[model samples]
Target: MSPASPTATSAIADGVTDDALKGLRRWNLGLTVLHAAQAVAILVLGNGFAIAVTSTFPEGPPGADAPAPSSLFEVSISVAIAVFLFLAAADHLVTATVGRGLYESDLRGGINRFRWAEYSISATIMIVLIGFYFGITDITAVVAVIGANVAMILFGWLQERVNPPGRTSTTMLPFWFGTVAGLAPWVAIVINLAGSDGAPGFVIGIFASLGLFFSTFAVNQWLQYRQVGPWKSYAFGEKTYLVLSLVAKSALAWQIFGGSLAG
Candidate 1:
């Protein structure tokens, strides 16, 4: 089905919210399918780089030469990271576009500045991650990761600086969520810096981080969808923002950590 248009749900959201959701859903089916296809391709191509006959990996430096973990385990891990990178790209594009497109569509809430900041920082992080993945894994990765963290710290400050009246209740969740999500990339970078052998520490840290993120999200979503009191009572904008942020962070953590392991 075609995605819903801007006005389709206008009655529900203040004009601004409706406009944002509409723009987000704009290329819904096509964008989602394309994203999925891209993810699959990256995984397949990435796997091909492996010297080991048992699995796939993208061609690259001796990074791939690192001794294999259990073949199944390594392949599975590689596939997970490839998927993470692709989705991070997709989410960054979609969220930023939605935030902007809403302004273009009739809901200009003094939010463009915030959206721009969010988009810019996110894109920068992705770029750094991309660069690091391609062979610049030493000090350069450290620098990029540090830069990304600084941007996010600034983002948290900017959020409060620009907070608008009436929306505080709703915006708090998303604001914090975004803040935390932005920090997730650094967690992987730090783990990488410590060392790499796909040691149990790295593997456990990656999975544990993911589990914590998703568990929070699933609980939030369940509460919201079930119309539970806690969900309804927590404040509207807050829950939505947090729910979205948690999911994004979990995915981001997965991708970066996966890439580190795969490489």
Candidate 2:
């Protein structure tokens, strides 16, 4: 009937937390591998289809009867990226378990800064696909969007739990970026659905969605490193890469949209 000391209570809570995380990690690891395999299979098949379609229909819209690379790549890539994202989510789920259950501190936690880098890069690739889609009308672009969106949501949730912004000026960027990026596509989609097709709604949707995805992705990774200790130590080079990727894609997205309009 003795009252427990605050220190003792904290330790007990930590132990319980650790056990829970361990279970989650085990579950996530298995799921992650499963998702990865599925993604690979899907992408391989989709790419093959793209080759077939491109060869079969080299000019304008496929004759209602002709095969089209556009459709093949679009659908195939979409499925591939979607599967990849599902696999990525397994990382968060697994990492969370590692951080909470296995590691005592941030350094030892399941997801280290490098892991964040990988996630950030993958997210960037997804956003880039959004731009590519505008130009090529292929599955790769669609799948990238799908994968990016899924990763953002899952990782965003993990960020809150494991790397919550601790009232730092620098930390605000990721939260805001993620908030905007995560919401942009949904907003654009709604707007496009309401707007007329010839009104250039698709173009607007593509831009908003891609911009939001990349900007948010950069912010998310920036925030991850910011929490590691000092902002000065954060990876500036990686940020540059992310920024360049976005810039490159933005131009391509615009060009694609322009081509569609001119034709």
Candidate 3:
């Protein structure tokens, strides 16, 4: 539903007035309703399937047949869209319900742990599911990729904290590191694709498409820090984020449905 970089750096003079903040908060609340509706529709209309898994741990003699892998937890891949969509809705719901003072303070500081936290889980899950279709089925590889995605998001959180507005315009180590971390999973996914004979064209399209969408979140933060034209307005960047979330999530949901989940 979202990507790296919680909010714009304070250095950008968006003149985020209280009225503007209130308006944006309402937008996020409205997003909650829309995302919730999509989640429900996905669950009601789509047939679900389990993502295969594997792991090794202390075990007794194998049964006459191959041992079933221990379940870290089971979730349906067919309805995966609903899962992340629900999570995104919950993130916005909390933002809307929370005290305005805290939300404004966090935004001003260039930190929104709520956004990163949800992205860490929601986006990671979506990517992992995508990787599965790429033939990245080894549990260790999957877990490692998941860790990389989560790390990328944590660095995005750090980007906000360490580089609060008015700080020296020196190097932004966290943002750069986060961007690299974001690349790791796609690299793994590509490797999976390479090993296979080939994959569906639409499947490859999913990879390229989502890769571009997620990349833009980092771009958004870069613009905020650079204080370039148009982006010089933090309000502009904020509005862009809402629009981005809507488009990116919808693109992903429909892409998955058309390419893999739909019969």
Model 2: per-residue lDDT, tens digit, 1-263?
A: 11221221122211224444455445445545655554454444333221111234445555556554543433334343543355355554555564433322432222244345445555544544443443423454344445556556455445433432222222344355456556554454445445645535565555655565556545545545554443232233223333443344334334333433222
Instruction: Rank candidates, lDDT, best first.
Output: 3, 1, 2
CA lDDT for candidate 2: 0.43
| Candidate 1 lowest-lDDT run of ten | 1-10
Clashing residue pairs in candidate 3 are 14-234
Candidate 1 lDDT by residue in tens digits, 145-176: 55765565455444433433233233345346
What TM-score does each of the candidates earn?
A: 0.31, 0.37, 0.84
Find the candidate with the highest lDDT and give its number: 3
Which residue runs does candidate 1 get wrong by more than 4 Å?
1-23, 48-81, 89-125, 133-135, 139-263
Sort the candidates on TM-score, descending order: 3, 2, 1
What tens digits encode model 3's per-residue C-alpha lDDT throughout 1-263?
12232334334335576777788798888999999998887777666656666554545676545455665555586567888899889988888886456666676655566778888998898888878778666688788889989998898888766665555553578899988988988998878788878889888888888888888988997887788888766666777776777777877887777765675
For TM-score, the strongest prediction is: 3
Model 1: how far residue 178 lies from native, Å: 14
TM-score of 2: 0.37
lDDT of each: 0.43, 0.43, 0.76
